[model samples]
Each structure stands twice: as structure tokens, then as C-alpha cells.
Target: TYTTLDIQNLLAGGAGNPIGHLATPAASRAPGEDEILGRVTLKYEPTDRLTMTLKASYDRNSVNNSSWNYVAFRCGLGSGISQLSGYACDNDKFVTHQNNMPADIAANFPYAKKDGQLYNRYESYAINGNVNYELDNITISSVTNFNRNNNRWTCACDFQSSNNATWATENSTWRSFSQEVRALTSFDAPINLMVGALYQKTRRNFGQWVAFAGLRNSAASPENQFVATSKTSFTKGETTALFGQVTWKIVPTVELAGGVRYTHETKDSFFTQPYNNPGVTGIFRDQNDPDGLGVVNANQTFNNWSPEVTLTWKPSRELLVYGAFKTAYKSGGFSNGGINSKFSTNPLADLTFDPERARGFEAGIKSTLADNQLRLNLTAFTYKYLDLQVDFFNSPIFAFQTLTADAKTRGIEAEFEYAPRAVAGLNVHGSLNYTKATYTKFPLAPCYAGQTPAQGCAAISAIDSRQNLNGAPLSVAPRWTGNFGVAYDTDLSSTLKLGTNVDVRYSGSYLASGFNNPLSRQSKYATLDAGVRVGAWDDNWVIALIGKNLTNRLYVSGVVDGPSTGSGTGTAAGIPADQLGFANLPRTVQIQLTKRF
Candidate 1:
């Protein structure tokens, strides 16, 4: 595959921005990513109206400094720091009347520094054939496609310390195969119709492993070692879809088009784990002993019917308008581990969850101007979601739940592009985009206060009450987001040509909701990127220089809050507040060369 574009990405660790105001200090790790890929294609044309093709593709990706990190300190009774007589006065609960031990340990434990490593490999092979034939007053065509893909990923979290070393590791793989066949027929005159039916099946496999140990001299003992392993398989899922479209020319320059597709999907999955043995201990089982646990099994199935309708209008050659209503479905599945330790006792029966569904409506306009050198497009959309499933970090009090109630989203997006034809050996192009997203409803409240293992079963009565949470904006997703870029190309001389591209993006502040409740919000920031290219040998070979996040702006992209839908707010007052702050990507640069023969 050829390099289509010089793209730059910015990263910010969970902190987003370095600590500038907090009395506590802040630190971050470096970030970088490099990728190389290749593909091949084969085609056969046995007849003028028939063609068959096959394609194979492969990719490898490696990234550094991908782990999560943070900074913080604590001061409390368990800190083991002996305070002056006043220190004992400051906290008396944990100490004698004269010893000021705070009611709770004042822990200021700093956030951990994350150094992440990830390896990914992907492969896909596909074959397709199409045939077109004319019969009397109509033209008919048949098309078929078969495709298979396999993906593997391994990632690790590095502690980067001499002691207190801990690591979270994961290994996962997915394989999918599918086939579809359809036919289209249209009349020769102004009236035309196309109808088709398609069937597809796919399967996926998933696995994970995690291990960690401290750096102490004797930390490797059986009690100190920690590890977990799991495996899941989805044997087969089927989808059947039917579609039809009709177009009336009305006149030579004016035409109207309408189409609809109805799709039914059914899926089945099986999960098993063989590592639980008798030797496991602590809050979780120990996978190191094969006899500690027995194999666990789970089965799940779901079916959904999705519908879509679209209309296209073209009054002239330079403009087009379209509107569509569509419904999309994502298969439901089960989680291998349950929220409570008690659920682990019956692993085979407790891991499965349900499916989620969404419906959307959108309308947009596209137009070209400036002698076809400039293009602009805009779309507005609104969607309703039922049984939305969200994943969150489990907390000590209320357990995490992946299911969410009714939700709604409404937003609009616009993109504009301008490219000037080469003039006097110089060419230039620029583009810009903007979008806004919001949530119509989010259910949240405080669960059992001062109760151990909080009972999160609580309902709301007032739609506008602080707990009702209607009209609250969705966390993590920025309300305003956009990017702009401009590029210029020219020949410096006969043997050398130069090109430069620059792009910038800005994201609005958003609340972190990884913990399930909204906490503090991160500040907004912008980033700039630039690159230059030089070429020789009739432009067959070229060297490029790139710089990313030139501004070095610090920003956080996401945050974690306490539990939602449950009363166990993690805050000091049993209130939910944001926690984890997903840092943004850092600035980086690279030099690359490419050659063609």
C-alpha cells in the first residue's frame, strides 16, 4: 500500500497538562508511534462485462509510552509518619487523646507513572466477483464477496521502578469470516429499480492474561504473586438483509432517488476458563495452579431487526442533498468476571451481559464551487439509544455495570475544503471541520450512604431534580471540536521539489466519567503539526521531516468518576467526583524515506 497522507497525532497522559497550580508536582512519560504496512491485489477479467478480484493485506504497529500515569500524595493515620503533639491533635480518631491520628489515613500517595507497550498484527484476505449483462429492455448485474480477517494484540503496563514493580498484561486475538451475494436490475429508460438480498456469518475469539509481582527481596512467595487469565469464543453469528431502491429521472437534468434496507441479525457465543485451581487465594483465584479452579462455560444469544431509509436529490451537476434514517445494532455478550467476589463462586453462570441498540436520523448537503476546486459539506444528526452498555472501572463500594438506560445525542458537523489548481509550479489546499455533541439524559444518584457494600438500587422521581440528571452533558465527549489544515507544494528546481503541510486541532473542556460519575473537568487546549517532503530520482524516492504537537500544549482528554446508577459515591462525602485524567499525546518528530521503482 502507498502512503496516502502525512498524518500526525497528539497524546497527553492522563494528566493532560502538567501541574501548574497544584501544590503537588507533576510528571509525564514520553510518547511515540511508528507504523509500516503492505498489501497485494490480483484480478481476473474473463469477459468485457465480468471481473473477479482478490486482495490480501498485512499490518504491524508498535507504540511506546502508552501506559497510564499520575501524581498525588497522602497524609493520614496509616502513613506511619509521627507528627508533633499538634499532629496528634489534628487527627485523634486513630490515636490516643494526646496522639492526633486523623479519623482516616491522610494518604497522599502519588499517582503511578505508566509506561505502556503494545504490539498489534493484522491480516485480511478477500475475494469478490461481479458480472453485468444486458437483456432486452433491462440491464442486470450480480455481485458476490467473501472476506476473512485476523487480528492480534498484546499490551503491557510498565511500572518503571526498581521496586514495587507491578504490571497489567493482556493478550487478545480476533478472527472473522463472512460472505455476501446480491443482484441488481435496472430498466433502460427514465424509470429504474434495484433489489438485492444478502447473507453473512462471522466468528470471533478473545483471550487475556495478566501478571504482577513486587520488587522486594522476598516478594515472589506464593502469597505475593498475582495473576489472572481468561478466554472466550464466539462460534457463529448470522445476518440476513434485504434492500430495494427506485430512481425516477423525471427529466434529463432532474432525478429523484429513494432506498431502504432491512436487516436481521442473530448471534451466539460460548465462554470457558480452565485456569482456576485449588491453590488460589486472596480476593481472587490464583491461575498459577491448574487444579485451583475448574473450566467455566457460558452461552449467550440475541436477535435484532434494523431498518434504513434514504433519499437523494440533485437539482444540478454542482450540488447534491441527502437525508437518511437508519437503525444499527451491536451484538450483546457476557463478561468473564462478575462485579462481586461472590459471583466468582459460580463463574460458569454469571458472566453474560445483554446487547445494545441505537437509531439515528441525519440530513446533509454537498456542493462544489470555484471551478470544481473547492468543496463543502455539512450534516446534522440526532440519535436515540436504548439499553446502552457502558464499561467502567470497578470500585470498592457499588460494583460497575455495563448497562445504561435510554440515552439521546444530537449534533451537527461541517467540513470545507479548498484546493487551487497548480499555477506557475505552485499548488495549495486547505480544509477545516467542526462538530458539537451533547447528551439529553443521564441517570445518576448517591446510593447507600455509610453502608458497607452499598445497595445501588435507587430510582428517581423528579425529571429535573439534581439526581434526575436530564439535559446534563455527556462526559468525555467535548461539546466543541474542530481541526484546520493547509498544504503547499512546489518545485524548487529540476532535481528537487518541496512540500509542506500544517494542521491544528482544538477540543473543549469535558468532565471525566470513567469512574461512572462526573467529577472535575479538564481545560481545553490546541495542538499544531507540520511536515516537509523532499524528492529526487524523478520523484520515485523521497525523504520527509515531520513535527507533531509543535505547541506542546498539555491537556487531558478523559476522566474517571465514582459509580453511576449506584449510591456508592467515592468522594469524601460519599459524592461522586471525577478521578482518572487521560493525558493527551506529547510532541514528537520523525524522518522517513520512501522509494518507488
Candidate 2:
């Protein structure tokens, strides 16, 4: 299947620039994708005491996107606005309407004609085998798995009448093999125990290149074009772990459980970009010398222990309470991408980050009311993170960077279901969650675009600065989110059953950037969904009609802050720094059919 998208924007007057303009000429943007998936599973019971299972699957997905971004706004185009003061100007008044805009406008306007295209292909396959053996007093299991993935992405950034456009490509391949063996003792005693050992080895090969089209006299001629490329490669990683867990019945109505895992991992990476193109010297600096250009050969090792403990109490058959404390760890890896040679110069300045560790505590209750007609579960949890891994845009170049910071999160989640015995074939369910996530300590966060030092940023330069986001809430973390739904099913005839369901979901407002700038915030919004299904022959065949986002509410789903550049078709200075991200999809309706054997 292929899909095409037509994006339109309205240029409304703002406080700073109060010259309203009609819609500009529309640009062409389209993205295409294809996906395929397959899986196979086999099981055999050669004997009464042993069983074996094997499974394999494959998935492939590809996408191709091409879009033209029109830079229609420029500074100092409005009346009484001094061009030297750097204010956006409304040039639409000088040109014809969007329907009959002249081609020569591209020559008179200061807009940049940008044509960007991206192609990505990803394929992965995995195979697994498992064996289970039962003994008189215990059960033993062994499993082995292997997986491989290959991905390639290429992007073309073409600008009109400019030699600065670039073509970037990245190719990655991964292979992993893992083995696990476990034993469980089911003794007729008050306590039960299980232990496991696991080992895994993974290898990765990655390559990237960025090519530039140097100064060219004409877009059709490539005689003067030269390409400047940068690349990085990562090679190997291995991990090993041992885990054990035990459960004890301390009393008739209470139980205690504990588990622990010890893990150790090591990784190696290499990077090199041996290119020297004079055309792009002003944009990217080459680090190659007599030794090499930006060559990084490094290795890192990490080890950690994670533990978990839980307690449960059941006073009666209808109610239960539980509490748990757990710890988790994630291994760290190297960072890649960017045109900077800092890694080659400093070697360790920002090459890698520390592992992330988290400690979490949770308590919950489960209850059944009105003689099992209603069920409710509620849980509250708090987690403290040490060296949490975070990804953010590095300034000046807008390259993505990974760092570590201390953070904390607390949240409450609740779910309930009611099925009244008197109301036949009717049920209702709802869930709600509240989260308060914050950065406990982060001193090196970059200030968002247009943010001043007084607004929580530590001044360093006019365009570069850091901020202490110690108490700032985490990006994309909404304080309130909830979903409510009701369902009904009834037998319409001897051979058919009809069912219907409706649900509503909502999310509160949240910041989109680490700087917590109000300009980068998304407002609260809600969506509704409904579905109807008809089944026949004891559900052997079924059909469903579903509708999503019935109201078609338009809202921003994400945001990013970056440099704003203009195409040569507008006045000058293009559009001001504004939030950039995709918006939620409009309302959709679909019908689906299923048959079971």
C-alpha cells in the first residue's frame, strides 16, 4: 500500500509581526512504506517426561519519503519593521495569490527550496528452541536463541541553487546468540526455589557517510561537486548473568518472595572518517592527520547486580494486598553521529556514558466486591534513577547526544471492571494514571532556542548556554492520563452474537523540551474510539467495524527546537524559531474480517 499526504499551513499574524497573509503555495510531500512478517512454531513430546519446542520468525519493513519544505517567511518584511532589527516580514502582499503565483517569485523571494528524501530498509529474523524435562520432584528447562538484523537508511537533503545540500547514509548489521538453563524445585514444602544461568554474545557493524554537493554553477551540472563524508563503526559486545528466585509461605495467608541477578558485560567500538574535501571545509572540519582522521578505538566493561523483593497478604478470598521493591540496570554504550572531531581530540570527552540504574518501590491492592461482580486494582510506585540515560539535541549542529542524569518518578495507576449480574451482557472498565517525573540533578542541559539566561540558563555565549534543570519536569511526561470504556454483548439469534464497545482516552498538558519553555508545550487533549463486532458459528467467523479519533481533534504530538533557515523564495530570515513535530492523525474508520479454523 502507498499513502500520500498533503500538508497545508495558515500564516496568521502574531504579536511581534502583525501582518496577516493568506496561505502560501503548497509543497509536495509524500512517504511510502511496505512491511511483511512471517512466523513458524513446532512442538514435539517424544516422551511423557520431556517436551521440545522450536520457533522462528522473520520481518521486513521498508519506507521511502520525499518532501519539499517551503521557507515562506522572512524578517523585516512588514511595514515599519526595520530589516536590521531582525523581524519577520510579510512578503505575501507583494506576490499573487497561491493559485497563480508566478515562477519568477522564486528568484525575487529569499526562500530556500528544500527537497528532502529518506529511504529505509530493515530486516530481522530470529530462531529459538526450548526443552523442558520433568523429574519426580523438580522441573528443568533449557533454551537457546539466535537473531540477526540488517538495516539501511539513506537521506538526501537538496536545496535549490546551493552547493551545501548533503546526502547521508547509514547501514547497520547485528547478530546475537543466547543460551539459558534453569531448574525449579517443586518440593511439597513451605518454600520453593528456582535458579537460572544465562550467557549471550552480540556483534554489531555500523557505517555512516555524509556527502556534500560542493559549489555548482547549475543544478543540472555536477562538474564542480565534491563530497565530504564522515563515518563511525561499532563492532562487538558480550554479556553473562546468573539469576535465582525463591518464594516462602511464612503463614497461611501471607507469602514472601525474593530474587537477584548478577550481570557483567563488555563492548568494543571503532570510528574513522578519513575524508578531506575542500568544498565543505567551512561546514565540517577534518580531523585526519599523519596518524588518521578522527579514529577512535575503544573498549568498555560494566558489571552490576539487581535485586527484587515482594510481600503479599490475603486476608480473605476476595481481597489481597502486595508490596514490592526492585532494582534494574542497563549497560552503557558509545555515542555516534555529528561532524565534530572532539572525540578524536579529547578521546573521552563525550564518547560514552555510564550505565543506568534504577530502584523502584511499589504497593498495590486487589479487591472483589458485590459477590465477584466488580473487580478493582490500584497501585502506586516511586522510582529513583542513578545515571539515567537521556538523549537530547546538542546545540550549534543539532546533533543528537546521549548523557546521564539523576532523576525520579512517582505515579499511581488504577483499573476497575464492573459486570452487574442483573444487566445481562454488559460490562464497564476504566483505568487512570497520574505521574510526577522530574530531573533530580542535571547541570549541563542546553537551553532551548530563544531562551534567555534569566530563564534558568547559565550564560556562556549568545547562542550557546547550559541550564540547571534540577527541578524541571521530564519532557513528554503528562501529569494525568486516563481511559474509560464500556462493552456490551448479546446473543441476537441461535447462530449470531453482537457486541459493541466504546472508549475515551485523555492526556494532560506537558512540556516538549528539557528547557521547559512555554513555547514548546503541548496542551491537553482527548480522543474517542468505538467498535462493533458480529460473530457467527460460535465465533468461528467474525467481522468488526472500528472508528478512531471520532472528533478529529488536531493537536501536536511532539516538538523539537532547532535552527530556522529560509528558502530563497521568501522575504528573508524565513520563519522564526518555532516548535516542530508531527500532529495527531485525523479521524479514521475501518472494517476488518476474521475466520478461524
Candidate that would win on lDDT? 2
Please, what are the lDDT tens digits per residue for candidate 2 over residues 396-416? 442446678899999999999
Query: How much is 50 displaced in model 1, in angstroms?
Result: 2.0
Q: For model 2, where is the 10-residue window of minimal lDDT? A: 1-10
TM-score of each: 0.69, 0.80
Model 2 has a clash total of: 15
Task: For each candidate in the order shown, give its overall lDDT on alpha carbons.
Answer: 0.47, 0.64
Best by TM-score: 2
lDDT of 2: 0.64
True-vs-predicted CA distance for residue 147, candidate 2, Å: 1.5
**Compared with the true structure, what per-residue lDDT tens digits does model 1 show for residues 1-597?**
000010000112311111111111112333234566676677777766656666656555544333332210111222322121112211112111111111111121111122223333455555555555555545555556666665543322222221112233333444444444444555568877877777777666555433322111123333222332233344556777777777777767556666667666665655444332122222233333244333434444565666666677787888988888878777676553332222245444344556777899989988997888878888888898776665643333212345455567778888887777745333343333343444445456332222122323233332111243345555566777788888777787888888888888877776554222423355566789999999983889899999998886655555332111113232233322213244554567879898986
